[model samples]
Target: MELFEGRPADCSGRQEREVRVYDLLDRLGIAYQRTDHVPAGTMEDCDRIDAVLEVTICKNLFLCNRQKTAFYLLMMPGNKAFRTKDLAAQLGVARLSFGTPEDMLRLLDVTPGSVSVMGLMNDRDNQVQLVIDRDVLKGERIGCHPCLNTSSLRFATSDLLEKVLPAMGHSPILVNL
Candidate 1:
């Protein structure tokens, strides 16, 4: 895949949700680089995208508490293993399991393969909390999907933490795991 700056010039076939991501980031004045590729459902699939984008695409997970009341969006290194018990103690939550696609779509307006921190923009009700792994925060840049796995985007870590998160009314909880 070739890296393109900002949104695709020709958005003819792009999904509305993907275009919305570009619109939001552009309006926020957050600089980013983008690349279009096949739908990547697994980390192995993202490896190619990561190589071309030159940044590891964060493994974004949509999770919910057992009762399904509390929802969270987790961003971590693709290589890192997720341990619920470890994250549970940090969040003071009893347990966390993969959120269903139904809840993911209802709250984040995203599907399984496209779960991203950018989707936090759709959570206007603040139903989903944002969580970032320390390792990811330390990076100068991070990559994520535009609420669609067919494409990925890269931007400064600071822009995401300082500009995007605040703009979305989200205060991310940093966890180490």
Candidate 2:
């Protein structure tokens, strides 16, 4: 994969959701680097994308409580081990489990392999809460899919916290794990 300064010049075959992410970042005046690749299905695939983007791609999980009423989008270090019990304890929730693909699409407008903080833009109802690991915030830049697994983007962490998230109308709850 090769890194480009911004969105592709020709978006003829790009997914609309991915293009929307680029549009939002441009509108927010947030500078970013982008790389297009095949859908990442494993850690090794992500590693290659990370190498090209020069940032550790976050492991974004779409989860929910047992009742499925409360949904969450979690951004954590790709290398970190995630224990549902640990996060459940921190959030004071009963049982946390991976949400259904249907719910992910309905809430974030993203599918299972494409969960991303950028997807928060589609959550107009504010139904899904953002949960980010503190470790991810320590970095100067963050890497994530642009609501699609076939492409990845990296931007200033500050842009995400101060600009992107705010523009998306979602506030993140920071956790250690």
Candidate 3:
């Protein structure tokens, strides 16, 4: 395993989820860079990881409507402010709140800071709708934790939106933020 410092350190015994993500990328022929880091579960932690990875790690928020019948996993630029009202209006759902850790684990198979677009791979039933901010779509490359917060990965934005999602049978809703 390579540390975020760009040095090839041994990630040999850890990172099962990240390994699966890399395998998925390899199978899809999507190029990416992986950076292993200390486990982080907050925005501050992500900032530290970003310094090493040299690209912004997107903020992934797992949300559910009041009824919990509708779930959304939203990805956006880390610096952007999230306005719940705007999102609710655009999505035509009632107010959305951060999902509980248990819900995240059960629905996306992810813990708190590890929430990511790759988690959609486990969303076989398509229960959680994926939403991406417009700014995130314009980036040349996007960074995300591979299904865990201890490591981050980068890939071309086009590959992620066009190839990987389609392969995973997920069609993301693009929302202008």
Candidate 4:
């Protein structure tokens, strides 16, 4: 797969999820800044990445309501703490918990570390909902993994909302948290 360095690696030779995201971005006419780094899913890991990418990485969580009927992909500022009670109250759900890895793979076609908004593309059934934190929306550019944890992509937040999400048949729900 492409390293997400300045140059585009030969993606044709790769058949990974990251390659698919890159292809989608290219087809959508969205320009982006990509940077390769170590795998990061926590604040400390994101801190190192932020130093290199000059942008905060979002905390992408896969969750389900108490009944497991409603699934969500919540993207928020990595540094922010997750308060389940607060989210449950705002969402009007009884309770929420991290979905199992099996559920994530079945519903979003993604593994744990590689969870991302781009995974929404796999949810053709519209089983998963997207929730974006208000703070993350304040930035002009949003950084996320390309369906893989090894590298990251930076693109205009507007492009993601206006083009990518629509193309994937999903719209993000903006929430303050």
| Candidate 1 Cα deviation (angstroms), residue 97 | 0.9
lDDT of 2 at 72: 91
lDDT of 3 by residue, 37-86 (tens): 77886678788777766678888999999988888999999999999999
Residue 173's lDDT within candidate 1 is 94
- Alpha-carbon shift of residue 129 in model 3 (angstroms): 0.4
User: How do all the candidates rank in terms of TM-score, highest first?
Assistant: 2, 1, 4, 3
Return the top candidate by lDDT: 2
List ranges where model 2 is wrong by over 4 Å.
Answer: none
Candidate 1 vs candidate 3: the lDDT winner is 1
- State the displacement of the C-alpha of residue 168, model 4, in Å, after optimal TM-score superposition: 0.8
| Model 4 whole-model lDDT (C-alpha atoms) | 0.83
Q: How do the residues 1-177 of candidate 2 rate in per-residue lDDT, one tens digit apiece?
A: 889998899988888999999999999999999998999999999999989988999999999999998999999999999999999999999999999999999888999899999999999999999999999999999999999999999999999999999999999999998
Reference-based lDDT, residue 164, model 2: 95
Clashing pairs in 3: 1-11
Model 1, backbone clash pairs (residues 3+ apart or across chains), number = 0
Model 1 bad stretches (over 4 Å): none
Q: Pick the candidate with the highest TM-score.
A: 2
Question: Could you give the C-alpha RMSD of every candidate to the true structure, in order shown?
Answer: 0.8, 0.6, 2.6, 2.4
- Candidate 2, number of clashes: 0
Error of 1 at 26 (Å): 0.7
Model 1, range 52-165, lDDT digits (tens) per residue?
989999989898899999999999999999999999899999999999999999999999889999899999999999999999988899999999999999999999988999
Supply the global lDDT for candidate 3. Answer: 0.83
- Compared with the true structure, all predictions reach lDDT values of 0.92, 0.94, 0.83, 0.83
Q: What stretches of model 3 exceed 4 Å from their correct place?
A: 1-12, 42-44
